[model samples]
Target: MALQPLPILPIEVLRQAALSRLRAGVAAANAPDADPSALKTLYIPRHRFEKLGPERAPLLHVVAKTDGGEGLSHELPLVASVGTLHINILLASGRAGAVDLDVKAAQLTQAVCLLLLEDQTFLEQFAYVEALRVSMEDGIARGDGGEFDVVLVQIELVMAEGQTQFEPRLPPNDFAQVDMTTDIGPVVGSDPPQDHTVRLRFEPEE
Candidate 1:
């Protein structure tokens, strides 16, 4: 027996795909031929991320948020899903630099969005996408002894409907033996009350 397949649109898988594309995009954008951009990308929970120090500034974090779906038709095993993704870009404002942290955040945010929307491989993850919206918010992330400028990018995706199938788990040895017996009464005009016995045996299919 083979293991069951996972959901066609798993949130974790999508999150990883987003991260891969972003990392590649960022690396390409900051290639040796171009001006280097200092940044780190992560896919982790908020609590764990809070433990990081200011040295990890100029970072990009990808987080998968809410997800929901609906059946395309009552008669079919099809579903239409929507997912929310967030990218938090942080830049250390405390660092002494000529460039403004706010401006840097904005630039980084643009790069993230552009990569997500333009990447064909990322877009192919959805079957039939109806719509996609990307929005951003500027704020500050206060830490134990410092604060960093943050650009929060939110992406809402309305994916196309797809067929869903369920598979049952089978035991290691799923063989069974079946036997059945039936009692039949004598014909209507039979001499006396008499019964006949019929036995049947079932076998597994080859």
Candidate 2:
């Protein structure tokens, strides 16, 4: 018998799930009085993503500074190093096409935070922890008409000695190094190939 392919959710579904995870983390960090039950009903339209691409945007592309908002400036106490995480999600027309989602760094950071919360053991392995910072940078185009949605997530582990203050700093490269791969298979009824789930793994430099 032929093997059956696994079911993959829609891109919008995945996006909403990711956003939910982000909201949960923010609530846990701050606003203990903030009702999570009410928060779940909060829905930010996809159009808000456009604000993230504008020049001189705020630290995080979130609408408010509340716990449910983007946790961009929250600092984590590190032992001896600075750790930075980034998450980027893009929805393009198709492969070989222009990038519709241009916020690369910020998206990566968000993904990293989600990953950390899901697995606290991974965080303990590191020596130091500091403020979690995320940024979105627009990428240059190689061609016109052609477009692709790409999500890049990155985590940076900066090693340091004892008594080092973990300040929120941007990577000199403007963005953390990233490796992209598909977490979920192609969509059920899509032309060509469309990955419903994209996974980005981040490893700090030695």
Candidate 3:
């Protein structure tokens, strides 16, 4: 018997793939009316939030980032497991033209969600596990300025492992950790295979 290498993809490659697709989706929706030039899409490299000035109105900020993914039971020819990726698509508009911006943002959100939910492979490699449209109040916009209404479209992806990156863990609650070290195999070395045990954790996120 032999072990086959797993199919892996660069994390940045996957992130950009999702970014481009979403940009296209929003672009296709247009804004308010049939005017294709009515909407503009911008990319922010950091995971933090940013404030949009009056000049940046009628613009969409596409932010993409990822975290370490959990592993899955894989077989031969697939030595590694895919991790979950989260991409946040934010829709924003300045206070001056805020009325129409809301409608436009909603439309863009709809388009992006519909395209992602399609029953086809994304990035020509990974299949999206899920996508959600959530509303974020005050947190995303920093700096003291007229409030900016932002709509968040969060997308989840499962792709092959890449460079290690981890999501900020809510510090472990005041609970003792369990020893997951398991013992298994034949009894040749005085180790009983049938007497093996497994552990499980069901604590809620803090």
TM-score of every candidate relative to the true structure: 0.58, 0.26, 0.44
Write model 2 residue lDDT over 1-206, tens digit each, in one string: 53332222122222333445555555554465654332222222344454432122212212212111123333653332222333333222345445344443344354445555465544444344444444333443222444333333223323111233345665665445678876677798998878798768776564
lDDT of 1: 0.61
How displaced is residue 27 in candidate 2, in Å? Answer: 27
Off by over 4 Å in 2: 1-109, 143-206
Stretches of candidate 1 off by over 4 Å are 1-5, 35-50, 73-77, 95-98, 128-206
Alpha carbon deviation, residue 61, candidate 1 (Å): 1.8
* Ten-residue stretch with the least lDDT total in model 3: 72-81
User: What is candidate 3's TM-score against the reference?
Assistant: 0.44
Q: For model 1, how does the per-residue alpha-carbon lDDT over 25-93 read when each residue is reduced to its tens digit?
A: 666655667655433333233332566654466656677665557666655455556666666655555
lDDT score of residue 2 within candidate 3:
32
Ranking by lDDT: 1, 3, 2
- Model 1 clash pairs are 128-160
> Using lDDT as the measure, which candidate wins?
1
| CA lDDT of every candidate | 0.61, 0.39, 0.48
- True lDDT of residue 199, candidate 1: 90
